[model samples]
Target: MAFELPPPLAELRTRVRAFVDDAVIPAEKAILEEDREKKRDTLNALRERTRAEGLFVPHLPKEHGGLGLGIMGMCALFREMGRSPVGAACFNCDAPDQGNMDLLLKAAAPAVRERWLAPLARGEITSGFAMTEPAPGAGADPSNLKTRATKVDGGWLIDGHKWYTTGGGDASFLIVMARTSDDPRTGATMFVVDRQADGVEHVRDVPVMSPPILQHREAELRFNSVRIGDDAVLGGVGEGFRLAQARLVPARLTHCMRWLGWADRALHMCREYVLTRESFGKTLAHHQMIQKKIADAVSGIHAGNLMTIHCASMLEQGLDKEARPYSSMAKNHVARLLCQILDDAIQMHGSLGYSEDMPFSLWYRFARSARIADGPDEVHDVVVARDFLRGALTTLV
Candidate 1:
């Protein structure tokens, strides 16, 4: 019955909108203009302003100097932030960092927190979560993990190769998944390896479509006899799988929520173009086909937003097990839908959307990877189907 946000949340959304329009949008233009060398500098300057506005780290707890907002509130803020691709990154709520921060807060030791989490929370240094590996490694299957952490005097020695490590190149610390027990029956365990540690090498930065990134630096990590203390274990031995899942659920939801705003912004751009651009004797908006496309774009965005909000609300209520199925559905659905919506918006823009002069083309490029990046749409679909069969589906449906 109550579909509208509460008064405080409504006010928060308005403020977020204003901040994004007045601040984030302008910064995006500057980012688009900057060369690869200058983008990081421009981004840092913009982030300083976001920090001053107290808009950074909305999901972090209050004790850690965050807004300490609930999931619904975070979803609202993230959607607004996602309106600009740089907004989430600027506010220190971007992926890898967002997920990394959540892990530290939830399960990391206080000593580990002192060494790494505090700096991360303050946005002083970057971090990465390395789970995916190349072929013959852990790609898409935790059970296929080939990375091994052999027991040795004082610490564990790590040896393996990883790719698509989203922020690995810039990360001061990496949460790595490796096999500690020899049975090969138990899933891989996770360890926190400092970036400067011996045998940890940054192969190279894999170029991606997103811009203004300090760590589009998804690199290949080679660990040959890399060492860390027994304290390096995150959570507990054999518990890495659980910890990884915990971090991923919220991470995927946040991604879906943020990208929904990006798609909304793209749709708005398409709508404005249609209303202004003339075709034959009339504006593009006058065409029935254009109207249908615009309608679908809006509908897709609404559906994605609804799914994200529902998941967020459930999470705030601590209904997480019930929420996981929805999170996967949302991540998979929204990621794919976002790509579709962006494609439609591009079609609506004609050649302009496909051109590098506009962010539309870049968004189209970035959108394609979303489905694959977060556990692929196929994986989420399987989870959803299994849940549906188990009769565990919830109000998020």
Candidate 2:
């Protein structure tokens, strides 16, 4: 089905696009110049401007002092923000933090929200999701979670070694996943660990391919004897797996939305370059090979966008009774297509494309990481295929 943007969303898209062209894009060079160190300084400036423009935190409700935009409107704004890699972050709508905010809003206690969510919402402090761990711990296979959180007097003792915890080093609080029960079926549980809590130690930050926007610092957290009250439990005990799934499904789709914006930008850069940059006795756009690449990139992005909107529309209308299958399909397909599009855009740009001089390399790096970060494509493929075969085989019988 062809999905259409509602009127409010359309206007939101236009406003975000203008914001990207004016405020966000101009700051990209400065960010790249100083790399990770530059983001704090740049964001300090952007935050003031975004707040003045009323473009900050569109997904958040106005009760919390945000724009109070819903799913559809936020999707449109996110796509425009994706146009500039720094766009959403500048507006305080970027991931890890955005996803963290959604979790706290959905499940955190009022006191918890006041403690963790408020500063994050106002862009005062950063947070991280400490779900991914090393080999034996929580990795691609969450079922292999090795962290242990035992009941203790007045609280729970959390002892786990979590790695690749995005935004970990700088996070004020970490939503940690640990195995709380020996019951094979319902063993996993989630606990909130404050950074200042005892036994919560930040290991070295793992360097990643992309620049650190909103401080995407992957760190190893050693929870020796960290403790928190029963209130620390998010959702409920033994519901960690279920809650994590719910948070991740929506989050994966949102990532797809943001990456679609990046893919769109990469294609636009290629289009502009091909039209002006001279090739073998002609402009690159005039060459059949270059034209085909552009066509494919456009088609890939369009298809990816449609699939994303389908899931998002259902989410908005509360029609997504169960969106696991569709969410899986959208996340996997968009990541695959985006990686392909960004690769082609880089190739079309030639050596310059591969160079840090262009954003294509950055886009490509992000595309590659997206495939593994949320869940590997192979894992999603298994999910889709298993469901499809079950339905099809039952029909055949």
Candidate 3:
């Protein structure tokens, strides 16, 4: 199936690209070293401006004060938002909030929607997804989950330790995955735990190799008898893994889309540099070596974008199960390409690209994490291999 954006979505994409280039990218320069509170304030101000421009929450339903764009539309728009490190946040569409919003919209009950999803969609608060845990617990395999949710008289008591919980420090709440039964296939359940709850403790932000603004601020969470009502269970008792997979597939592809934009921008910077910079009595652009890097980067980016849109189309057509293999392939392929493109750009610029004077260094550091986040390359490789063995190789064809 053709994945071309319709005329309206094409227009929206252009508008978002212009806004990101003119507003978001310029604002990002000022907030690179801003304090946490100041960062929040600056992003909030940008969100207001984005709303005024009628581009806020463009992926959510129109009933939720968004533009009601589907997955295909999001694929196009998110790439523009990725042009700036903070572009997605400025438009109220950054993760883990963006992924959380998608989950709540599909899984939350009416009351839960009113209490949590409404504010999230409006960008009134931030949220986190807590699934990964320390060793001896769940990491790549959810079946090994160690977090427990024991039923009590009133509701449930959740006790566990989760590391790499993205945005946990500043989130108003977290969607926590806890084991509630003995069945490995259906033991885990998702609970909505408030950040201010008595038993919820934030240990520290795990250090990562990424730009300060782009770093996910991975939090170590300790849930000690965190009490919550029956209302907190999301998508019912045994659907944690199922629901998480739903969130992850799209989340992975969106990451690809945004990183694609960042890589594209880096390539553009490299092209400009090569054309203007002289080397050995000739412009760098005239060098065959430099031209090869540019050509490869462009070709890789085109392939990555195609894979991203193909995955988006699968999700849009309600084929999440069928899309898993493609999702893994795209995530692994595009994430690697993102790093390679940034590396090429840095190499072409020599010392300047490696320095803080340019954004290539920052983009390189951030793109490195894309390979590990939302499932690492190794895991995705296993997924692709397994799918091939099962004869679900149509996606590859």
Candidate of highest lDDT: 3
Q: Would you give me the overall lDDT of model 1?
A: 0.82
**Residue-level lDDT tens digits of model 1 in 356-389:** 7777778777668788886888888888999988
Better by lDDT, candidate 3 or 1: 3
CA lDDT of every candidate: 0.82, 0.81, 0.87
lDDT score at residue 283, model 1, on the 0-100 scale? 99
The candidates, ranked best first by TM-score, are: 3, 1, 2
Each candidate structure's TM-score, on Cα atoms with residue i matched to residue i, is 0.94, 0.94, 0.97
Worst 10 residues of 3 by lDDT: 30-39
Query: After superposition, which runs of candidate 3 have C-alpha atoms over 4 Å from their true positions?
Result: 35-38, 395-397
Q: Report the lDDT of model 3 for residue 320.
A: 89
Of 1 and 3, the candidate ahead on TM-score is 3
lDDT of 1 at 87: 80
Clashing pairs in 1: none
Better of 1 and 2 by TM-score: 1
Please give the distance, in angstroms, between residue 168's alpha carbon in candidate 2 and its true position after superposition.
0.3
Worst 10 residues of 2 by lDDT: 388-397
